[model samples]
Target: MRFFLEFLEFLENMQLMLIINTIMKMPTVTKIIYRLKDEGLLDTRICDNDNRVTQVSLTEQGWTMVEKINEIASLLLTDSFTGLKPNDIKKLNEYLKILKANLQ
Candidate 1:
């Protein structure tokens, strides 16, 4: 039970992390931006057209971190799908698509 809870927590964090990565330079970035900035992974500057607007960019170190994170994520996903038949994989994808469409 404890391991299941921890796994759920990790999965939630992974999903949130991906969402943050997708919109790190927009009108809805998280307050964790400060921590990223402190780590020298994120750089922010004022927009030229609007001094009140802030723009965010990733540093070189940030890009390296993102690449590493993606590699790990790919490994985890690949391992999770190991030894699956091609038809099973296709059926799973189709079910996922149906579920996604219904949820949407």
Candidate 2:
């Protein structure tokens, strides 16, 4: 999900270690990338400018899953707000933020 979100934001190939470094450790990132590649959700290639670097991007199926996930999230959000007035939703959001802060 994190990789898909980053890919969606950039829409470009990224270095494997660089992207993963922002989210996790190097070894775990490599393992996860290999798993994702095996699942056909991602693709990796040797970087053109750096022999030691690997480039990564999402596959078609990964994009499809991202779209479906987005649709589901939107549906759930809309359903959750059903019959709520604008002010009510605003207050609900404020309350949720407070709860989140407390949890954190």
For residues 1-104, write the lDDT of model 2, one tens digit per residue.
55544454364544446655886888887787788789888888887898888777778987777777778888999999999999999999999999999999
lDDT of 1 by residue, 1-104 (tens): 22222232344324444544564643334455556778877677776897865556666876666666767778998998899998989999999999999999
Instruction: Quote each prediction's TM-score.
Output: 0.63, 0.74
Task: List where candidate 1 sits over 4 angstroms from the true fold.
Answer: 1-30, 101-104
Model 2 residue 47 distance off true place after TM-score fit, in angstroms: 0.9
Q: Which stretches of candidate 2 lie over 4 Å from their true place?
A: 1-19
lDDT minimum window of 10 residues, candidate 2: 7-16
Candidate with maximal TM-score: 2
lDDT measured at residue 86 in model 1 versus the true structure, 0 to 100: 86
lDDT of 1: 0.62
Q: What's the true lDDT of residue 87 in model 2?
A: 100
